[model samples]
Target chain A: MTISDNDDGGGTTVVAGTTGRLTQWSTKRNRWIDAIGISAAIAVALDVYLGIWVTPPDKVQGNLVRLLYIHPAIATVALYVAFPLAALSSALWLWRRTRSPFFDRLAVASVETGIFFIALTIVTGSLWGRPVWGVYWTWDATLTTTALLLLEFLGYIAIRKSTADPERRARRSAIVALVAFVDVPLIQSTMVWWKTLHQKATVLLGSSSQIHGIMAMTFALSFLAFGLLCLWMIINRYRIEAIREELEARRMEDAINDRIAESNIRVDDLLAANTAPANTVRSDI
Target chain B: MAPFALLVLILFAFALGPDRTPLINATPGLFWVAVLFSTMFAIQRSFSLEATEGLHDSIILAGIDPAGFFIGKLLAIGAELGVLEILTAAGIIILYGAHVTSMLVLLFSCVLGTIGLSAAGTMYGALVSGMRLRETLLPLLFLPVASPVLIAGTRSWQAGLAGEHISASPWMWILVAFAVLYICVGVVLYGPMEDM
Candidate 1:
């Protein structure tokens, strides 16, 4: 760390360079990203060939019900991934001072991607609801919680963007993320705890019988696919962010160099003028 | 933190289950009552300890991460809430005849709800730590943030007691989500809150 002194009491300290652990971590994350992509492909294959074609369709919902495999899977992935992203980003903000900018950006990416999948879930859910329940949307516990969860994510993103000070922004946004986590379970329980219109759990803990062999396989594959999608998105988002950060650092270095060069030129001109005056005095003497 | 929490627990016991008889229709109300008092007390006392006796700077200087400080405080609050919850639950079960089909879900929901309250309240406390009317502003900010937790916990408890096909999964998930989100916000904003 380099400590720059100010005449005032405030001392501005910057960690001079990235640490080894960070580099190793980033590399590991990249590898994980690659792994996630491969896993996603496999999941996609399983879901398509097995879930859509190999598995028999529901007698009631018919062929149009193929979307079920993807919808809930995506929704589950969205919820699962959002919590970690928000948490890691927030932790990065508080524990380490230098990582705030990157973490904050990562938090934004997670929120954006979460919103994408959540919106997909809601839209698909509504579509399913329409055919099954004869309604496009209902204020059921599940739906209500989902909407609120989306809003909370939006709030996190909005607050992050609204703040100008990087430190303040990071801290405040992290606070928002922590606060919003309270809703995750509340949203989940709202459906079952209350008399909501949403269906009960097709999958409950300690109850494997609820899931059939083929449907279970499809659900598991769909879950894997969606998980892969989330991992891919997070990795890509992190990479783009790393590049942007590198560029920003380079830009800062360039600006500093320019300033130093300009100052050097000014000093040279002043010395030349002083030498010229001294030469004239010597010549006159 | 301990003293403040104890006070809150005491108040919760008195308010909901007075003289060993739980209030009528108290199953749902008990959860909210506990949450309200606990949050109120926790948020108020959260920063007060740091604010008083010039200890906040010592905490900062100890290299104890600000977010860690918040979490520590929240944990204290949660502990206090846990004790209060146990007492309240006992009273409700004995006095109000509240059923406990799935003790796991009920207790888990209680834990989650308290965590959510404490997590969000910690941030609000820090945000208002330096304000002139911090005590007043803390609830204003915290209550709105924690409304969802209260509603979810209350509803979950009610359904659990009623044994009317209560799906405990959603409430647990929401509580987990709330804890994650609250921790994120607290970590990110601690720098600014500390500066203030």
Candidate 2:
């Protein structure tokens, strides 16, 4: 629970809990993330109960409408929200005053979670599309853009893996995230206009139309549940990322120590090749 | 880059196997593909050039604005790709026997599309430039992210070549949007990418 409980070469492990804030503030922030997660889980469970059994079947689509509970929730969180957070955190990380390892880790964590949900969105959309659109995949704009977004972020995560140094990796990944976020709007706009079997926005902004009645309530609750679920996933991922960073810093310290020992022996060998005592020679035996 | 684009076209010609009419029909898409791969080659070269000999470090140390460096590279790649575009366009015209009906639309598409492609390719090339697997990794990373460009570029080309039934303004706007978006992102984020 303490900040310096385990220190490895000043890891300065950045989390809301470890950013040199007062312990009470840190503790409160940690609790806040967890609380959101707990509430998200509860909301989602309730949503499942209401969406599956309570909400009436759509007058046209029948019980097949149950996909509504999960699909839009996952899509909105993955595509629209996660990327923006990643981009914002990345921008923050690049600034001097606002920069922190917390933002770096948060950016990657958001993108990683975003990746997971985008993949889910595609899978769920396909599952929903199979019965509705008569095909598992289509050239439809939303579907294509979603697929593209997933691939674009796969690159982001790939760049993250391409390096071991956290700061360097974070910088590279941040650039990728920023570029991806900017591209996404154009991607969606172009793709949607390109060709689409998908419907236009129904629940979120920019749609002139609105859904009403029990269906509306279920959808709203599901959106909240899913949004919270995204929050929970990212918060947990960010914490794990912080711990992983600490482990990496510790590993690096061990490597530095090993290097020092090796160099010391080399220096001694160069200095004592002719004068060193036989018994005092650095012993491998 | 021109050689790579020529090679792609050569390969396409062989794959399509001497159907002049079909080659002509496929000219628009094949042309963009060549330009796409060419842009990829130019980006990899531009970044690799910068990554060597402590050039990048010196730039940072000398306190040259990273944004200007990015813009400089962006324009360099854009200019180089511009030449490659003319060569590829000629290759498409002569090889595919293409008949251009809308010359203005075609040139607009080429100009705007290359700018977008170069901006995106430059940023991504920088992203992977220092890696051991950059050669193998750059395409794997950049191509998917560049899908919008690919899609939009193709549509614009299509509108230019066979756009008799439709106007090219919308697709051109897409090209404009992509170019502007990536440039803005590149200018802003170049500092972070170049900081190290």
Candidate 3:
């Protein structure tokens, strides 16, 4: 009954027996993340109130412009999501060399959030653009390249899902994420390199005169809010996936145990039959 | 030297522009066409060089960084592209009545756009390098990725030729973004692709 070579200094570790301590740890992490997420949402609502009610409307765009709460915030989130994904993918591939369920979950969540915001950015951009650029879509550098950026991400996820084996899928997806991550900044500069129909940057962000007062505050708060939400989603997805893995491990263990018990019973029956036949020979004699 | 000869031939094409609209108006399309065709020629040589020389397996066994591998290939492609761009610039000045207003902007855009092209081309090259239908897949993959650079480059160059408000500053940043994207995708993906 004893399993040899136990690694935890031969100490009895109950959590390892069947409880799945790591999965439980992930669940705890998710709860904390969710709490933070709720607070962040509240902060966003407060910031939106401040932005629309308190902050003065742009002299050019006017009161129809409070959409700034979401516009730049979404773009910022999009940038934030890709870099970490690249790092994680690279780390998992180079170091772990195994399909880490944790990293896989993180990558999926990040990309999903990225796609969501990108959609928001595109939609808000169009809504903002229609009032500003007078058209829904233009072949402008900013819009065109951004669309291409999203397509590249989509392609990454597509490849991951299309692959059948989880290990191979993880390895391959990690590669795609890393490569796509490197391209983020390069693609961004293309609009600047060549003449594009898009307008130049008005806000250098954090430059004193570029943005200030209520506008600045709202931007900061909304960014925090969106960032928190992204974090929450990642943590939640990671925990859920960890639980799934735990269940899978349990199922496999149960299956092996059932096979062992069945084989043991067969051995017992054979021994009983052999002993009984030996004893029965005396009665026949 | 072979590349140089190819460069000279491309220069001759620029020189013998259609006797209709001055080369300036027509040069944008021609310039990109030259870039595209030249890039295509170079792309064909990408994996074939290693396969023919039998060095492909050696590189794999040596365990060089996949990103490094990507850069190595891109540099070769970039050098070829650089020569083509320089020739195109010369043609723009000599044959077309164009002035090199901001050499910095022109050079920057050319470099960044080339980076985008090479990054994407190298990735696709790697993907299909071992495939039976590589030649067919390469163009299919390269064209869609290169389209942005073509549209942007042609528009940028046309603006420069027309002596319009050619602010390369904005577009330069855009090209930078494009380059970053391609590099990221290639670097992250190409190593595992080596196995494939």
Candidate 4:
């Protein structure tokens, strides 16, 4: 392996392997990520304040409605944003022409972030449900599908971790993602037909007439905040994954080099012993 | 497979207690659950058969079409699970004193459910075929994907037992859709999976 210094302005270090594949390392953090992270934090704090203090309690749901700002937004990110992005990246990785480590890393990052959001969604939703629904959990359609999705993606991560070979791991996890993606709709449809207690979508589906004006605005803000936060988390996770893969590759290359060096030393010792006098060899023994 | 599934049926009865009423009520779901468990074993056995003696490599070297190989395994596992289902169903009927009203619905659901389970099992079995931890990983990967089959199968069996043919039809259709979907997916994706 040869390290070719590409003097690009991006501060990327390109390592070209014997296979002629160039691995680019972006070691610098982007200013945009910091801006997005700061903005996300601010937006979330403001939304939480407005949701808890400013918005009036619902006549029916009472103060329990406060959970809506974060729960639904987190759920939306988990199901709508993160899942589709993971699935899309997995598909891109699977395709022959568009196949790249970038997509595989993105898929893993999206899945990890998605799992975090899913756990948050479940926890927040359960916190609200305990008082209203009288249960922390139920086998309702929405909850069941979300739980199943969590398990499926957990399995995806398991399969990814099971293999040490990067190429095999990428291919296997991509297939698992696609399979899980295809099952999501089927699981949703069957679960809906089986049973449901979760409320229907009212805000984002253009049925906002049911919600008050300020409440709707806060809801939208909550989504924006969570969306930005999700994006920031995925980007960071992707960078971490990239760095981990680079380190693994380097470690593997070093191990191979060490093995080669050891073998070379052994061959040199054999040659020295063969070329040396027999009496010297006996003395060494 | 039959003995294992029958043992599962007996174990369910033991766990549910001696109350015949609850046992009868739970028979439909328990039977399908038994089938699901047996399906995993059947898949593992099918793949392990290939794993031993390097049959998978030979099959590849012999240039057998992957789609055909997948379908063949699907059929073999499906047939094994089908027979096991019959044994378990009989065990449930005898031990749990469950009554079957609509034999047609019961048979249809069993056939459709077997296809779905076996199709998915074969796909996942092939996916983790040569892995070291496949025994644990396969169920983690396979069970959640096969939950829809469990739901549809149990519902259909319940309706069939209650003599509600109309109610059973929709669930059977879900079973049909599930089987068809997984079969098509297996046929298309199995080739790539085998390549891996």
Ranked by TM-score from best down, the candidates are: 4, 2, 3, 1
Off by over 4 Å in 1: A1-16, A19-32, A88-112, A164-166, A186-195, A205-213, A266-285, B1-192
Q: How well does each candidate superpose onto the true structure, as a TM-score?
A: 0.54, 0.84, 0.59, 0.92
Q: Please give, for every candidate in the order listed, the TM-score of chain B alone compared with the true chain B.
A: 0.82, 0.93, 0.83, 0.97
Model 3 CA deviation exceeding 4 Å by range: A1-21, A27-30, A52-56, A81-92, A95-101, A196-215, A241-285, B1-119, B125-192
**Interface RMSD of each candidate, angstroms, one decimal:** 5.5, 1.5, 4.7, 0.8
TM-score on 0 to 1 scale for chain A of candidate 4: 0.86
How large is the C-alpha RMSD of every model relative to the true structure?
A: 12.4, 5.1, 10.6, 4.8
Each candidate's DockQ: 0.13, 0.65, 0.16, 0.81
Q: Over the stretch A1-285, how does candidate 2's per-residue lDDT look in tens digits?
A: 232544432334443333333322333346678789889989999888988888888778888888988898888898778988999998888777998888998898899999999899999889888888799999988888888888888888777887887778877877777777777778888887789779866566555644567777888898899898898888778767766665565456555655676677777879877444444332422
- Candidate 1 local lDDT, A231-284, one digit each (tens): 788767665554444444444655575567566666876887533222222231
| Worst 10 contiguous positions by lDDT, candidate 4 chain B | B1-10
Best candidate (score: TM-score)? 4
The candidate scoring highest on lDDT is 4
Question: iRMS value of model 1?
Answer: 5.5
Per model, kept true contacts as a fraction are 0.24, 0.70, 0.22, 0.68
Docking class of 3: incorrect
What's the CA error at residue A239 for candidate 3, in Å? 2.8
